[model samples]
Target chain A: MAFQIVINLIIACMWMFLNESYTFASFVAGYLWGILLLFLLNRFIPDTFYLRRVGKVIKLIFLFIRELVLSNIEIVKLVYKRQPQFEPGIFMLPLDLKSNWEITLLANLITLTPGTLSVAIAHDNSHIFIHAMHIDDIDESIRSIKDTFEKAIMEVTR
Target chain B: MIETGIDITLNISVSLFILIGTFFVLSSSLGIARFPDIYTRLHAATKASTLGISSMLIGTFLFLYAEHDIVSGKLLLAIVFILLTAPVSGHMISRAAHKSGVKPVTANRSDAYEDALQKHRKNS
Candidate 1:
């Protein structure tokens, strides 16, 4: 991925030098041209094209933002309630993610989204403990996490 | 600084965003005061505060761009940095609290971490 980015940037710079135009527009055009060139030559590359990963990353960001907004609204409602009655508990989440960074990212996203905070991880990286402000049904909450954030993360990383 | 129609519109929107941000931040503080346990308090402190600060920063960014025609990269960077770091800090605090055996106020359901720890000890 780094090599591909370096090649694209070099192409962009060479295009700017060749055209004698050091403007942002020319650089963007050159970048687009580089993308097209790379797309055409993608078959020869061993790994998947970098733009696909970039697109997946953008999708993950949108997914996160959507979750954040929805949960924030929920938090607002909970905050203003006259008599708040909710079950807050700690539960285990068995992780599908491997690697320290992936687990860290998952933990961060869970905490950032309102209502759920990741508390700790198992020594073998098999499970994460989460403390949620409201868990109507433990199984349901676990499934939602698996479906939304976990699925989106797996799509991006794997 | 100009009193153009667009400038007025921008000013209104900026104020609107800041107002919303302040409301969330205030409610989050209320949450911290009212919540019974450390874990519940963390939910309020981390999530609401994050959205509140991000909204305020965005409003500031828009205001600067509209009034001065200068995009402030620093404000944008600050928003990103907060979004990135707030969760880590929240996680660290919660983990520390749990490790030190600070039980939650109302855990109607099972405490999985404590169960796991007991199971680990038995195995060892």
Candidate 2:
């Protein structure tokens, strides 16, 4: 668990430091020290860590990227196909996986994708209602999201 | 002559920072517009805006550092405060929205989390 936490912290630092705008010696010093402490503690903690199915994650990411690119292209085409008829509405999608972090990631990913946005997560975490940009066939849209995107998330999180 | 190079570099960085900041702000707005609903919109706007404003503020600080002295440091301090608060506020807003019966995208199987919430509500 500590190792996982340390890795997460390192990831945060890496993300922050990538910009490298400021020249604060103290900031850099503090960052290094925090990382070192986390690393040392990580070695001692025995926490149940989810071993990501790497091959699955890679495959899913690839599939997601493909779909994302395709989704964007389709959205652009729809926009350009004059006389745009967007029959948009809210879709209530049932959540399969229950992990809070997993659900959060899934929702964020949906938001990032074109044409679909995760509007609200039911307080019960049972459903995630999304507002579709154009709901021509809500069922079809749900099927695509569930089969393609949400399933991939299951593979990663499970 | 010595100050000329510093001034030009500083000007360029300032413009770049401002441009990036503006882009982020726009992106956040776009996120709000294009995202599905309130919760999603909040997430998109908050994430993008934080990064965007921070970049702009950082750029501003750097430009100020190069151009002036001392006073600009105060500006950096203010930016730090904003960076600290924005995410927290966004989280609180989203959580409140969620608690007030905001519907999420419908899920597939049984939701244990929802059961817990329901039970808690009942007991209380």
Lowest summed lDDT over 10 consecutive residues: which window, candidate 2 chain A? A71-80
Cα lDDT of model 1 by residue, A1-158, tens digit: 88999989998999999999999999999999999999999998668799999998999888777877777787788889989776888888999999898899899888866578898999999999998776667677788888888888888888
**Per-model chain A TM:** 0.91, 0.62
- Give the TM-score between model 1's chain B and the true chain B: 0.92
Give the CA lDDT, 0 to 100, for residue A91 in model 2: 57
TM-score of each: 0.94, 0.44
lDDT tens readout by residue for model 1, B1-124: 4568788999999999999999889988998898778988888888888889999999999999997999999999999898889889998998899889898865565678888988999999
- Global CA lDDT of candidate 2, please? 0.62
